[model samples]
Target chain A: MPQQRVVRTIIIADQQGLHLRQAVECAQAAGRYQSQIILVSGERRAENCRSPFEILQLGAGYGAAVTIEATGPDAEQAVEEIAAILSRQTSH
Target chain B: MEIKRGVAVSPGVAIGPAWVLDTEEVRIGERFIATGTYPEEIERFDRAVQAAANEARQIQKTVSERLGEQYGAIFGAHAALIEDPNLRQEVAAQIRDHSFTAEYALSRVIRRRAKILAGLNDRILADRQSDLFDIEKRLLRQLVGQRQAQLQKLSEAAILLAHDLAPSETAQLDRQHVLAFATEAGGRTSHTAIVANALGIPAVVGLGPFLTDVSGGDLVIVDGNRGLLILDPDAETLERYRQAQAAQAGHERELIELRDLPAITRDGVRILLLGNIEFPEEAAQILERGADGVGLYRTEFLYLGRKEDPTEQEHFQAYLKVLRQLPGKPIVIRTLDIGADKFRSAVEPPAQERNPFLGVRSLRLCLHNKSLFRVQLRAILRASAFGDVRIMFPMVSTLAELREAKLLLHDVMDELNEEQVPFNPQIPVGTMIEVPSAALIADLLAKEVNFFSIGTNDLIQYVLAADRTNENVAYLYNASDPAVLRLIEQVVRAAERHGIPVNVCGEMGAEPMYAFVLIGLGLRQLSTPPSAIPELKRLIRSITVEEARRAAQAALQMESAQDITNYLRDQIRRILPEALAV
Candidate 1:
């Protein structure tokens, strides 16, 4: 049986917005593992935050609180990495 | 032996002795009957294949350690293929009976594998040029070790005329000696083509089959603008090309001298000829070339060079460096222009993207990534306090988007106020009228944004529904097309109604011939490359806006886009008869 992990992360910075670089980082880190990653906004569960194009497609604006859940090998690692990405609220 | 004829890619005339690069040859082993037992021959062949595999692995490691994992992976894959169990058995059978050298044996395998990867490299490279550079880097390492390779011994300032250049080899090219580049294997949209364009070096590719016949030093001339390659030209043709080159040199000297002169017309009509630049260092070069100010500073590169979002401080320093150089000149900075097509990050990347250029890029990407966009806005606004600076948004197609973007700009201002950072409160924010919706409703969008700069690159592409790279439709991608012309007119008229200044910043503005027409069409402020200033100044000093307006009206009345393009191209041909054909 695989361990499950859930992390609540609030997008703090509203000004710069969650950009392509951040989304790319999130997607790239998550894509490396075989974890089933899902970004949940209230009742909506956004599938696989590992693709920047998909993240942009979601139209997830700034200051939005989204829950991240990961399950599989390296699930805890993926959730923590994505949470850290959101905490910064910006990418270079 | 001495050779003088070759396309001038980098543009320093050199007369150097012939140095031929190693010509990759196709090898086929001749079958010879086995003198000994078959199993013994098979064993010997297996050992030879293993040796080749070991050699490949070492090369892969060296490449990976020197370059990166991405480059190393390419050779590693090739090594795997070379050592594949099936291939080893097949090639081993041929070599033992035929008694061929390792070079011949390797070529035989490569020829069969070529059919699979055949043209996929170019297709993949067209979508992402950086990927092709990865391949080119690996090939350069492989070539360096080859015994017969002749490029190692080349003397200074020579023109490199090859069949085609892999990305690694292109990266390794010594600009000091390579005057120009021409190849038989690359198209206008190929990796080599973009590199040539960026370097501003003259190059022509895709002159297929001609690569096989030319020696190392055959007098070759590359006309990049027209995609023409002349080989073995007689004395008369050489003299004509040399004269053309000389005149271009003279023209450049004239621009340098004009650097100190004010960019004014004969009637003393003061026009602002600003430089559209990328790097902050390039801004210095632009000023040195006599630009009035920095008209278009592409902010995308700040985000592009690094894997992370640039810190507000990082962005400020880069902007300040340029501002310090030109204290009085206005710097119009466009926000980050990245999307699926031009991203520089490593993770959850814009993967397996399709049509990134037309899809989520520029302003659309900005909206999706608000946090990233806000930081840039704050920095640009902060930088404005140091000198005259204006912020512009690219690919703005909607009034709603413009409204939202402005509000975001305001939000940044609020943060700066809280942080007690000093910045200009009245800094003007502008939107580019590159899309049809923005141009059509320019009056409305112009109200929200401070000004409009007509980005004809995107404007022409969208209006004509033609990708400039697409060979089938590239002929249709004309800015002079009546549809595009009408859009430009609409945007300019709308800007006038609101008293907002409108400018042009496309390749069209850079050409001296098109400068006349753009001026006549009512674009008073023009931003182009620094090198184009003197010629444009000379052109402006010669023609009145009235003559240009007359030409524009006739151009719009032409039936087909090609007709209009031809008419405009010909009109400019007469104005500056020796300008590049494009």
Candidate 2:
């Protein structure tokens, strides 16, 4: 069996963008996966998906594109979950 | 003796040992560790991180259960950040590679990361740096074994000296042991100041850069009335404060003796002396002080220092508490009167406004956020069924704003009816005559509302165009300014014309000189802090309404605020010499 890597780019759909609470949601979603995940925005990249601090440092604003990259056995699942969090619009 | 001056938020005099709180600026002096102790340093760091993470989780659980999951999630995010594997890796690397102590290594890594977040273009994202700094503080406390001063567990009475106090910290303060407090930072309306006033604790705040000059257990004086913090006072200064404290005690006893008496002028004109309170608990104090009823029950405290907007139930519960405490008494529940900057946690982040006071606040904020307004209106309506609960809209500058607020109140009433919830449909609704425009058009506005509460604090600032908190222009913010006096007079006259009851509910109503002016201006009702009620009663009994009117007329004709102030002082001195002492 070979190691697999998955990458997906998603636009921030929440009106407040990737704020602290949204970043928490992203980190919590990434924490459930076994694969290592990273979020990339512009020139900056957050290597640790489980750290909300790093994810927030990505400074992804509303409608800004963010790239999620994952590797390991559950790389595809990790990418899907993280992308859903980034693309989902939260009313509150 | 060293003296520092700041804004006096609460009134009194206290002499006690200082309990200086350890601020967030924890200096890590020992930067390097022995080469052989790298493993031990890493273990120490790991233990601190574990403890900090556990504390964050505990707070999250408690806060989530109390406030809501939204607020709890804030602490949850902090816990995740505390246990961040990337952060741990960097700290361990610093210790292993550079022989750095855990405290120094952690601070360096956290500061570097926080700086990055702070430098980001996104304002909201940049604000997260505060969370990072908070985490750093928690970690440092654990690593250094320097626990935060347990304000709740103090054994001896002391005056607290701190750089700043979060609302949560101030909420947990054990009032019995805290005789008074002086802070290096805060304004008149800060949570600490409000709590101090509520607790009747002497407090002076916004004394910049004094915490570094003082130490724990050093004798200090918190002269809240004078807004002065004196350190290691000389014998003469100490004797003076001691005598002043004694005089105040005697004066308070004298006032308390008059608590059962009515605030009727010598000419037989009865005046309504109501108490203005921030919390529901203060209702009892108002009754004890012999107030007629609550003139202004500020509802902003419930919304402050919390992560989420208070639920409809929370609002109802708070109003019900006050109503139950003051049964059959008029409780004027002023609808959410906070500026956006004050309650950032409750309100969604609006674009940063340069002038927040003049920006969307109070009734304007309520109108824009209808759900927030609806929830409060529903609560007030529901509470009205229990007792006399009057709803008053704050910062109603225009007739349309007042009408719109009334329309929403009606909407809430309709909803309550549809839901089959019991409430008083005809509950009295009023508007605060705070803005200058509202004061000018009081005649028109009086016809719309059941009553009018003159909020002099905002009215003075708005008319004078001075921010009282800004020291440079604070002198311009005067209640005795002829312009302010004339506007107050106009409002009273307009209210009289419409046969609507009007009262002064700001700080002006609490002061002897200003209260005299207000009485003379034809204000029959005055709402002040409960502690001030007894003294006001004494003043009311001393002078005739006729005399007050004459004094006020003289004041209105004066050219300068200083002249009017001096004239009123002289008049008050002649009538009641003791009132001038306050």
Candidate 3:
């Protein structure tokens, strides 16, 4: 096997849903490592933590669970980091 | 490699891969639904439509993970708009009755009723942001479609290249990856440039339509310091940027040489040199550039771009953050100087006037609305306990107005004390010497205030009756004009007679060319952006009091403003060519 990365689910339970501040925190955390971060929800998937709008395109509303996958030297770290961001309430 | 050029919005240079943040891809998804399709098609359309919206939200969440909540919020807001009852019903009705897919149904309603969705109270309707949506709604329908054009996400620590970007889209940028930005479309003071300055990102904007010449990920060199853009860099171009960067670094290294050096003249007169900052992060630069303190912390930014008024606690926390960073530095916070050209969502809707530039605004508005001023005053008074805090009011036209503002500050301070809030009771309050009436009666106004900071930007505009934005009157916006200098000289003398200190925090002060002239005019304090500190420090060190005083005395004899400008230009051109060139 070449390489494998684990994908886990994250629920956007916050009413504000996945907003920009969380995106920034998540991206910064993911950026700390050398990993390819990816987010998959339903049949659609994208680069997990990219720009704020890209994350919103997944349209994972309240009560929706999102799959987050990271692969690279620091895959596990990236997943943990993004998960933490998605867990917080919107800081408005 | 590709190359382009534009107006330099901010300064600094860094090279990296390209990360273009575009919002076009966050549009309605596609679905194939016939007008006369089977009954089952309508249900499928509804399901697809819901899924598309769901997909958009998930994408927003994922990107927010990468970028931040700002981008997440924008999409979140859009997501909410779609979920609005009227809109949801309209889209659902269109899907069922017109037999259209959900994405198609939503897009139709959005396109046809863009005005309704983008009214002053509309979900898409925002003051500064409305204009961007107006442009994007049109462009999104034409150039972009869901899943057609790919939105790029570059590795961290990369420069951004783009033809153009909306202000909100630009601001939501993760500045870490985006080192420098060069745009195809923008003006000198475009929103993109404004946000770039706020983000402290080195940006070159307003390159016109020429950005189309460059494509994706071409090796680009944005010399924002010189407003030059080089593409397909040859060895010489690369070496030039490297050398220029090294020399710039050397210049900064020399600036650090002034870290502990006092801003003193040959005559041994010492002056406080401070920096004007717009954001909290800029506090770091204030220290790095060796500013004695912050002369003018424009709190207008706190009210700008924000959807709601900043709570007193929020403002206190921000002020505390900056004050803690620069413990002993005097931070003169100019309270919410919005008006004349700025507006915030929290502000009352401005009545359409014949001439807004001369309309009732700034201090006039704040005085009229006591609650607005009180919230800010409470925040300031609360934060004062932490550091050397001072308050300066803008657009004060009379002594009574100064008294009124001071009274409001007292009320806020009393409340803070009663509420057991710790604050600096003896905090000095000042008024901007901008209104001509205030300058003419400087003696009376100075009596009511603790200090004065001449807002030369507006002072010149009001005194000369010259709108700086008007091209024809721009010629009158000269900072070195005799009329303006004379007013400043008068104000300085009045402040001296009253035993109060006066400082200049306008662009005129920031301009290194007038560093000596202002000091010679009895100004012991000059607050400018830190970028100009190195050059200003050079001018301050180079001149003797004897020379500056004589020049000021001679220049005062000139009658016309142009004569004063020409005189200062020639005088500085003769000496301190480096500062002038910079």
Candidate 4:
């Protein structure tokens, strides 16, 4: 069977953008799923959603559009969880 | 013996052995490893990463338990980064593919990542570049087998000497064993200085590069009062410092004896002494110092040093903390007084103001961001229900701004009323007369507010057009200047005419000489630091209002700020000869 793929685009709404703390949170959430997650912002693509450095290098500042794509058995759950973490408006 | 000068941030003297903190830079011996040794290098890298992760977790546990969960969370984040599978993979790949040494591979990967972060346009993200470097140092320490100079595990009391201290290291400082600290780099407003002040530890910063001149276990004297770091003091100098230390203690004891006494003049005029505190935890110290109440509860701390603007609930909790601590006492909650630059995360991209002091700051920033202003007002109103909470707006240079702020407060009050929130609807509103325009038109402002609080620190700076922090022009920023005195007198006269009480809630009120002038200029209330209340009360108790008024009248007639300052000093010296010793 072909691997299931899930994709969703969300705007970074956090006041401080997708900062280190938020990046850490997103990576932690992505690490839980057995799926390959990719975060695309503008022309840059973070190949490893589980890597905070890759996610941070995306430079997904406030209001920047980010597309989360996942491919695996739990692709849908991975994308949703990663999107939820990135779209949080408050730091806490 | 060598003497070095720096900026004195926290007061008091500390004499102890020096504990030199090593810089974070790690030396990597070899950059590359032989192809045959690549596998061994990878194993070493893995072990180092594990050790660094363990260290981070250990710090997190100790800091979380000692400081708070929030501070502990910083280390937890560090641990997560240290144990990052991606970071480990990159380091291992560097070692295997390039045949790089473990130390070199870790440094190369971390530095590249840090450079990426540093190059980012976002300041908040760019600031985290240091954290990456910190992690690199931690891992490198493990790989190099270098023992960390653990400040938290100091066995004996010592004066910490360092080129600079990281925020994490400063937070983990064991106050019992860390007597005081002096650094070769830092300013008055640095995080290290603020932490030292909060911990009541003597600290001097920005002493230039003198770490090489001294070694660990060298006896040192940190004269925080004079911003001097005396390394290997001579016997004569040491004896003088010992006497000074004893004198300081004796002086404090003498002031503590006057805590219960009212700030009443010899001629029977009672003066209200209050405290200016930044944190809610300081409310108890104000009461202990025998202050009447809190005159200026600076609310900016809630908005500063945080990732986001404090929620309305957070603001309410902070105000409620102070209120619960000082029941029935008047607490003046000054609204947000920070510049727009500070809220760059919440607001638009920073425009890099050439002069932030004159830019959209304080009340102006609040007016531009009404939602932010309303959140604070709502919180203040909510907390007003608990105690005698009076709202004060800072940097109101114009009548329109004051009217607009008051209008917003009314709107917030109405909203609270609709929501059936119990609050003091009749809560007093006041304006900080710091701007020269506010002082010039004090009568107009007095009519709009329940009271007036003369903030002489900014008033002197504005009137003289001098930056107090700039050493070159700091002399011009004198409270004893006739221009400043005239403004205070005008504001006082205006408040008197309008039948409103005036309070001086600036550093000017803390000094005996200045307090004499302020009291003579007809200010019945003075708010100063909690530590200053007893001394100010002592000064108040030593002189008569008649004498103070006469001295003030003479000082106002003087020509230069220097002349007026000398005149006031002479008057104060005669009134309280013991004040000179302090």
Off by over 4 Å in 4: A1-92, B1-12, B15-94, B97-137, B140-170, B180-198, B202-238, B305-307, B345-356, B469-475, B580-582
Report the C-alpha lDDT of model 4 over B1-582, residue by residue, as the tens digit. 999999998899989899988764566755788778888888888888889989988887876666545456677778788878889898889888888888888888888887887677766666566577668878888988997756777888999998876556776788899888898877764445655776678989889999999999999999999999999999999999999999999998988889998999999999999999987778888888999999999987687544468899999999999999999899999999876545443544333455767998899988988988899999999999999999999999999999999999999989998999999999999999999999989999988999999888888888999998779999888888888898899999999999999999999899888998888988899999998899899999988899888878887788888898888888878878889622
Indicate the DockQ of the complex predicted as candidate 4: 0.21
Best by DockQ: 2
State, as a TM-score between 0 and 1, how close model 3 is to the true structure: 0.66
Error of 4 at B366 (Å): 2.2
DockQ of each: 0.03, 0.25, 0.02, 0.21
- Put the candidates in DockQ order, highest first: 2, 4, 1, 3
Give per-residue lDDT, candidate 3, residue B35: 68
lDDT of each: 0.66, 0.84, 0.69, 0.84
> Each candidate's TM vs. the true structure?
0.63, 0.67, 0.66, 0.71
Docking class of 3: incorrect
lDDT of 2 by residue, B1-582 (tens): 999999999999999999988885678865798888999999999999999999878877865554445455567777888888789999999999999999999989988997887688665555465567668888998998987645688898999888876443564577889999888877774445665775678999889999878889999999999899999999999999999999989988888889888889999999999999876767788878999999999988777544478999999998888888888889899999987545443445443455778998888888888988898888899898999889898999999998999988888888889999998877888889999999989999999999999999999999999989779999999988999999999999999999999999999988888888889999999999998888888889988999999998988899999999889888888888767633
Candidate 2: residue pairs that collide: none
- Candidate 3 residue runs with Cα over 4 Å from true position: A1-92, B1-220, B223-231, B235-238, B279-281, B301-311, B340-359, B408-422
Of models 2 and 4, which has the larger lDDT? 4
Candidate 1 chain A TM is 0.77
**Pairs of residues at least 3 apart in sequence or in different chains that clash in candidate 4:** none
For B1-582, candidate 1 gives per-residue lDDT tens digits of 112233333333322222335446322344343455555645555555555456556756765554444344444544444444444554565556565433344345444434333333324223222322332223333432333233435566556776677543553455566666666565544445555555555666666666556677666666554555666666887787788778767977876787788766665677789889877767777768888888889877676534576888889898998999888989999998776545544433443344656688899888877887887888898898899999999988888888888888888899899999989999988888788778889989877878789888888988878888768989888766788877787888888989999989888798775676677678888999877877777677666667778998887677787787787778778776755647
The count of backbone overlaps in candidate 1 is 30
Instruction: Report the C-alpha displacement of residue B296, candidate 1, in angstroms.
Output: 1.9
